[model samples]
Target: MTAVHVTPTEGVDQPTVLPASRRDVVLSYIALTKPRIIELLLLTTVPVMFLAAQDVPPLWLVVATVVGGTLSAGSANALNCVVDADIDQLMRRTSRRPLPRHQVSTNGALYFGLALGVVSTVWLWTLVNPLSAMLALAANVFYVIGYTMILKRRTTQNIVWGGAAGCFPALIGWTAVTNELAWAPVVLFMVVFFWTPPHFWALAMRYREDYAAASVPMLPSVASSDEVSRQIVIYSWVMVATSLLLWPYTGWFYPAMAITLGIIFLIEAYDLRSRARDTEDLSIIKPMRLFHFSNAYLALLFVAAAIDPFVK
Candidate 1:
């Protein structure tokens, strides 16, 4: 006898029959971890470690922290996939995920996520420090329970506050080095917090229909293009300002790069707002330009921070 499963198809609940293949099973398990997201998170983490050291950090500590952070972030992302499987099936953007495609069982994914979470804590505690471990655990819990379970469905402000979970890498990186937190990491944390809305909202604008189909009240899906663009500009300003706050701790080189990169980010953000004011058509709006630039802006800015310590 063949197996049958029911999954959401483009907002309609329907039955799908898919046989899980061996290679697909392996890939599907990795998909639950969301490797691209982990890459971005590590981009923030390692650079902060460099700045925290103000010199070369120990090779062993950096490797350990990266490994531990990977496990922790992977756990959060996997659990998120489990919780959002229903909505994931509904939206075309997430329709091909392992859960929606029946490539992985929910219970299996759930246990995998849990086990990763426990291992991350122990790995960080034993190799990094207790504070770093605790920070990772808190971020894991907040992302799963606070953001995915509570805010994602209930409000349009979901990613704004929920993005705090991503900000933990700065704290974790700093603590992994010095075994304590400071204003420098806090400033970097605020930069990420403020940056999340504009970054996510731009992508959300491109996928507004998918979000609407899923009944997820993302700002872009529920709000007008003008309103969303306006908010993006607002957050972009705050994000750039918060980024500058790190200059005092860094050096002249960091501020110079921050100011230059920030100007480019603002230019792109305002351009999006201007285009949005003229037309609601996504084709003309081209929000993804800003979306892609934002990613580079962040990566470059953090890279500058990491390099400043050496050049200063």
Candidate 2:
């Protein structure tokens, strides 16, 4: 096969070449799924499986659950790219995505998403359990219909409730282990639920004008910086408080880590709030500081949750 070559178009920052080989095509489709986002979802997942088992789960079960969960999230994100392609083109942050770059057509992305969704559902049902399969499907539906289709363009609070879709991994992880739901996983679910708003809002704060230009009403785009900051602080407190609820079940280590992480999280939130209150220049706000930290915060917290049972 001859290699396809791409060069930059005059005045364009990105290369204009299409995929030249089967490998490039496969990777382009995978890129449509937004694998980084899937990693975070899996971060919340694997920890809960360990916590649910109260020990390490079987190696095969862990591998199966992670694979199924990745496919499910990939489906949802690919569909999201399809649905959001229009606004995605308008936002500098997302303008180079496969759909906007024409590396993947809308129809192709849609079909890929649906196929992954179906495959993941069947994989979970056969290898894990029917309940876990259904929950994965429900998360996909909720994200596609509830968040992307219904709420994204319509509301300022889109991410707050839309984020419920991302919380399903904790439940899916727990069920994959115990084959049933329990209160501990529910607490983990809420931890991700409350964590979503502040985490997302910080990024939205940095990209407020991009969202404004795209005409999507993310909270940061529609509200005052002070208002957005206040809400971030509020949600930070709530997320920290919710993390504490696992203490009775998880014991000292989880709570100790929670309190320690929560303090740093609160400090960042408050620092962002202070900057918002004092500065008129949005560039000075440094919202990405909190955004990056939130990612680390959640990853570390959940890892601690997974390790808590072994210590006790």
TM-score leader? 1
If scored against the real structure, what TM-score would every candidate get? 0.95, 0.94
Number of residue pairs clashing in candidate 1, backbone atoms closer than 3 angstroms, sequence gap of 3 or more or interchain: 0
Model 1, 1-312: lDDT tens digits are 111233454445443536457787778889999999999999999999999999989999999999999999999999999899888878777777888877788888899999999999999999999999999999999999999999999999999999999999999999999999999999999999999999999999999988888789999999999999999999999999999998779779899999999999999999999999967899999999999998999899999989998894
Tens-digit lDDT string for candidate 2 (4-43): 2233223334434588888989999999889999999999
* lDDT on C-alpha atoms for all candidate structures: 0.91, 0.90
Error of 1 at 290 (Å): 0.7
Cand. 1 TM to true fold? 0.95
Summing lDDT over every window of 10 consecutive residues in candidate 2, give the lowest-scoring window: 1-10
| RMSD of each predicted structure | 3.0, 4.5
Model 2 residue pairs with clashes: none
